[model samples]
Target: MAELQIAEIPYEDGGIRYRYARRLSEDGTRWIRDGRFTAYHPNGAIASEGTYSDGIEQGLWRDYHDNGRIAAEGQYDRGQESGVWRYWDSDGRDVNG
Candidate 1:
């Protein structure tokens, strides 16, 4: 097995900053996401966080609003959303309630 490496990439769109950091492993051909994944919003707040397996999303995932509030959270299976999902408004109010 190839040693896993973590990479952090920063992006700018219309003067807004964004970041994507993830664990990657070489699959004998190319690098693939294989562990924790995190994305930051333009304001440097966590936009989303999750785990990846073999380049696919797996397990629980959470998304947050720019104000540092939880926006949504749910489970993922093989990169597809699965099971129950809960959402909240930007003000942190539960949207499903």
Candidate 2:
């Protein structure tokens, strides 16, 4: 794993923007903010992910779908969802939308 840092990266296949990425942690480790993350696709589409701090979902958070919809999302709060949370279906569609 690489050290955490704030930097911009390209999508997994260089299709879109992937910013602020950090190394994935161990199973027991919690996601924290050092300004790092990634956005990718399972089949093909957008998916963002990351961590967050100060009640904000920060770092490496991703959102998108394999069918060009919304698949799901990412979290790193070390706790439950709070303050401005969103949900999506398996196809990456927003539930609230």
Q: Pick the candidate with the highest lDDT.
A: 1
How does each model score on lDDT?
0.80, 0.53
- Candidate 1 residue 50 C-alpha distance from true site, Å: 0.4
Which of the numbered candidates is closest to the native, going by highest TM-score?
1
Query: In model 2, which runs have C-alpha deviations exceeding 4 angstroms?
Result: 1-20, 23-33, 51-62, 71-79, 90-97
In model 1, where is the ten-residue run with the lowest total lDDT? 15-24
Give the Å error, residue 46, model 2. 3.3
Q: What tens digits encode model 1's per-residue C-alpha lDDT throughout 32-78?
A: 78788888887788889888888898999999998999999999999
Task: Candidate 1: list runs displaced more than 4 Å.
Answer: 13-27
RMSD of each: 3.0, 7.4
lDDT, residue 58, model 2 = 47
Compose the digit string of candidate 2's lDDT tens values, residues 9-81: 5656755564554444555365434453455554435566655543245433546656655554445454454
Error of 2 at 3 (Å): 8.2
